[model samples]
Target: MLSRSTGRTRHVLTISTLGLTVALALSAALGGPAAQGRAPAAADAGWSSASPFAAAGSELSGTVTVPARRGRDTVVKLWLSNARLTSVPDACRSTVTVRERASSVSADGRALTCLVRSTGSRRTISLDALVDGEPGQQVDVTVMVDGRATPLGARLVTPGVPVPQPDLRLLSSPDFLNADVGDLVRGPGFWRPGRTANSTNADYRRALDTILDDWRAERPESVLVAGDLVEGWWGTEVDRSGNFGPDRTLAQRKAALRRAAATYYPQWKERFAERGLEVHAAMGDHEFGDNPWRAEKRRLAPLFEKEFTKRFGRRADGSPRYADRPRGSKHELSAYAWRPRPDVQVLTLNVFDATAGGMRIRLDRPQLRWVERVLREARQDGVRWVVAQGHTPIVGPVRSHGSSKLTYEGGAHSPLWRLFKRYGVDLYLSGEVHDVTAVHRDGILQVSHGGLFAFGLTNYLLVDVYEDRMELDLRDYATHWRDAPDGTRLWETRPQGMPKHLQVSPTPFTIGTAVVDGEGHLLDRSGILEQYTG
Candidate 1:
């Protein structure tokens, strides 16, 4: 009977630039002779006027105004974070870089971007050095650009760390589950203190406030809410006496969700904007609507899509709804891919669509095919690792008779499990079980973020993927903080195994149930099950 959203947005600030040269010295001068008048105040500078970077986050964009004496060719060297190191030469070109305390120099340019840890409370982003020659040859050095001094002043990093995985500091409640407010009675249900409070009122403001404070202390790069951002399907109906009772009206649910989004998501976005922290997101069951494949649920798709477009800033035509882009918006109904750093390529799949909002999980034929396409592309492009994230746990420790009952009994594996296995998916992250569980089945790692806003226990899982190694940190909310809670260390798995590496498997392991023992047997667990009716 469990349901929740899977995946999250892990923003990678791109350090794109052109022109490259050997390391050059940065002049310790301010506002070079090119300045005819006083430079803009710090407040007026685009950096301060726009959004601020996260704790160790910073962004810079400008052409290196070097003297022509170096050569007819002008090059800028941009050093990105060290963690982005890859076996592929220049694999990090023009893409978002996701690492801390690292720098990148453009292969052909003189721009250098780095995210250094905060000294005291301030993080620094500098055009540290300018190089204007070959890799091993001498190059001219210029510190000041257009009257601006080199290594610009460091400022206070806002919003601090991104909340994706769990740390030892804060706990995250599973968010994207299509749970009714009533089901969360035993724990700290996230409800707003207003009339608009209904099924969609997740008190993210209070919850995130707590998480943000903890991040300020620990300084994580990003935060991940996983999926099920909204309860678009609360209006579905069944029986009144059953726990899956008469659902609310679609209008009612929509209004509640709308209010909740209007009330908090903007603030959340603004908070992220202020810190220049990239907010990573993934589609959940609720994002589309419960039982998305159902004919009735399909009718609601437009409405849900509209709301989603508005929040994510996409256009009506389903483009990356960037304010500066166009009339389009960011609408990813199937699959979206990203790279945390040059080494990590994350593919977010809309797995719920396979069920089409019905009782069975099936990978959309297109997405199933696309998964292979994206993986091949990433590998060809020299991606060091590939991680797939979705909302449902295809494999876990929970055992149950497959039932569509509405209260945490949907514990059977989805057909996509084999697809994941075929791909040798390194990490499968999901939320719905309402309890944190990490296990390795057939060399693939499955992590359930579990549920939050219940029994006063909320949590999230953190994962750090290094070269040939990874670290999983699970953070649960401490009960003391009503709004936010403490996080407990749940479990981790980076065990040695057969080259579960990124090599593509010709065939995925079959999707079936495994014996409680480690027999590695496949059971006929296909198809959605009915809810557990005691």
Candidate 2:
């Protein structure tokens, strides 16, 4: 029987750049005839160009005149342009105008910006304004061509607080278990004996395509990858004449791993570059190896440093290789923070590159020190949102104890968790166990979605962050899993026994959950669930 969630579900399809172009053109054409009118005297002033002009394909550009400060009636034109796209097509001319209206105030009160676009022939177009306003401020905008009477109106208004970000979509299936079947020579992990339908996997290729499509559609400022790109273990191989790896050189194994990575990773890389999306990845266990104990990590760290720096690094210099984060940086691994927009700060951590292992848990003192300093500086800088992502999760359900659960600070609980509590980390993103889970401790949120290469898996998660809330969406590939007991569908039903600060809400054909709290306690639940075929 098909899962109930798959019966009537809404899938977030990947819409390409071409799709956006069509939408823009259609919207402008449909609105042109309805807006046929002209404004007063400003028409006689002759044609005047807007202050800022966007290059082609730029999603936003244009100018409007507004009072310099609150309470002033005089308005001067302030033009702003975004140089992102190559050029704006002539077809976009009809949808332009000047904007005037009080919109939402920024975290810091500043000049209000409204949404306005260009219209055909009428250079002096009035756009809608939705920025915040202190009393007594006003501006005048005359969007006019050389001689034609341009239509003008102040329709822009402050946008309502954006809804919490939506959850990412995930698609899953029984067939996902077969993902690595024919690619025995690939993947850095040993293969287990199981039916193709029993393996856990994700449709990475499809997900990559969807992400690119979404980026073109939304034009997000930056994309963040939490970690875990490779399996990090020897790939499944046919046992030949009882031969084992005691004789195989590490160098030979490394070479084989690289070949597999090269074969499987090209498509993902091309998709990222083509979209012009700024891509950031946090090194995961798979990128190096699974169960990377502290000692093993110490040894593997140099090897990976060489591999990435010499092989897969990218920078503004157009070099396809890794560059040191900075001179004299103590982070022997690639861990740093970046801000794509003024409102958001992303901190990526290479948690695996420290001194600890299955028999011992230790946070390399230097790395720990660096983390504290970075967090302190970021908070002091008045950064509103901080998102931390890495490969190993500080807390989650794991099956066999290997590395993360082994030892800790002075043989106590892992130090990473304590750090999270102390620094007020907002969200934690990780992948290791091939499962989807949302665990919240106090107000801190940890969203985990791994299992991309289980087999015939087709699933990915969607996350959305809104001003007042955060939303999570888990999408399955072709079908949904249903409750077998009563054959009843589950949708948007809150989970049971959640702490006051933590909450889970299920949605139609999907599981939508939100943990509401500015601060709360997150208990540790470290046992992995037994595998079952339902």
Candidate 2 residue-wise lDDT, 1-534, digit = tens:
001111121111111121111111111011111114643222111112222121121122233322122322221122111111111111122111111221111111122222223222222223222222222222122232222222222212222222122222112111111122123333343333331111112333343354346444544445556555544342212211111122144455445445444433443445567877656666555455445344534555455544543323554364642332322443443666665444345666665434444422233556666667767666788755556776555554432211243212331145666666676777776655445455655356665544443221233333344333333334332222223254422110011110111111111112222322234432211111111122
Candidate 1 TM-score over all chains jointly: 0.45
lDDT of each: 0.37, 0.35
260: Cα error in model 2, Å: 4.0
lDDT of 1: 0.37
Q: Give per-residue lDDT, candidate 1, residue 128.
A: 21
Q: Which stretches of model 2 miss by more than 4 angstroms? A: 1-220, 234-247, 292-301, 309-313, 316-333, 354-363, 396-413, 454-461, 466-469, 479-510, 515-534
| Per-residue lDDT value at 375 in model 1 | 71
lDDT of 1 by residue, 1-534 (tens): 000011321222221111212133222223212233655212112222333332321222222323332212222323222111111111112111112222333222332333222233322222221111222222222233223332322223333223233211111223522233321222122333331222222343344445545444444454555565544443343211212222366665445444434543454455555655555555565666554357656655556555655766444475653222111112343346656577666766555432244534435556666667667677678766656666666654532221121221233344456655555566666665555445566656665554434223344444544343444434434332222133221110101111111111111111011111112222211111111122
In model 2, state the lDDT of residue 98.
15
The number of the candidate with the highest TM-score is 2
